[model samples]
Target: MTPTTGRRPLIGVSTYLEAGTRWGVWELPAALLPAGYPRLVQRAGGIAAMLPPDDPAHAAATVARLDGVVIAGGPDVDPSRYGAERDPRTGPPAEARDAWELALIEAALASGTPLLGICRGMQLLNVALGGTLVQHIDGHARTPGTFGHHTVKPVPGTRYEEAVPEETSVPTYHHQAVDRLGRGLLASAYATDGTVEAVELEDPGAGWVLGVQWHPEMGEDTRVMEALLLSARPAPLSPSGV
Candidate 1:
């Protein structure tokens, strides 16, 4: 369903390109993302726009027009980004995507635009902020290419805790975890094994910035997305009703 009235906050969701995809009498590289990403944004009262990987030079200009940004989950980030050798468990590098999304992250942060990073997106955010990654972890994923359900507990009195007041089950599919806290970021939630499941900007004045190691778009919980929408909302009128 489309919004018939009012201004819907424009949300930019990063996407990947599947090279050499064939479909419906066309064969070419295809920019792609799971439909759930857009659907979730729309359901949360935002106008979702897919952002295909592009020249890093244009990232600032691209984000300037968006009210919010979401770095959707995908391939593992290149280990070289964090100054580590690639682990055998790490997926092949999608260097173009890395460059593009890293640029977007920087732009979003610099502009103070509300941003949400999911799975690999969360890792990328850390890398962009001078943090390192675990590279690989066992028992996080139940199987290859599949998601598992797990309970995540939020740190008390945090924005993440405010968004999710209680422990919640979330769909997770990742083998890497944050190994160090990013600059000006705090771990806001954790898994039973003490894996960092969620993080947010440490400074309350940094604007809205949150990252999750799980796929919220793939789950039924709308609170996380709702929080983003709240941040995207226009400020209310003054007491005199300006």
Candidate 2:
């Protein structure tokens, strides 16, 4: 696989904007992300930047500067996002995050910026593209406060399969999974229970867009991230354009 060349690609990962976070004897609204997200980016030859919930109007402009975007996994997507009623088991709405990340996903898709969505990120991606989700599922996240594992089998001839083209065990932790696929998005991988574990845009011209139900950041494999960094590089200037 090709590493990002010449300069380290700038990778922007969306973060959580919580109501109150306590650290050092003070509690305040904070924008934070799991350390693993940045570590994964750094390990894959890119510069990691944290993207806090910001004005939705600024999303397109913000994405214009980054080489790629990762909508980091977080809270359950508000059921209303895809015109769905809230399931009894659905987690309460994270309205701000939903709006912000949806804008970010739109911007990334519009700009054809390499985008990877993990867990909640993946769910929001589906919503952004006019798809619905399974609000709750079983056995995926059995133990509280701990990560689980499952094998994800990739579809033949998919970009995801090219990255890790086998039935591979992944570090899994999600209660929701993709139900109805989004427009032009293909189910790239699946769990043994037939859960959609991965989805990617069907059109290669749409740039690198992939969402994994499992969190690659929480695992040891770098192939998935490496694929993102590789796609982050800008294409060469042609004789006519240059």
Please give the CA lDDT of all the candidate structures.
0.90, 0.90
TM-score per model over all chains: 0.93, 0.95
Q: Kindly list the per-residue Cα lDDT of model 2 for residues 1-242, writing each as its tens digit.
A: 44533667789999999999999999999999999999999988888999999999999999999999999998899888888889898888888888889999999999889999999988899989999999889888667768889999999999999999889999988899899999999999999999999999999888999999998888889899889989987555466753
Provide the lDDT at 203 for model 2.
Answer: 92
lDDT of 1 at 161: 98
Quick one: how many clashes does candidate 2 have?
0
Point out where model 1 deviates above 4 Å.
1-5, 234-242
lDDT of 1 by residue, 141-212 (tens): 667768899999999989999999899999999989999887999999999999999989999898899999
Error of 2 at 232 (Å): 1.0
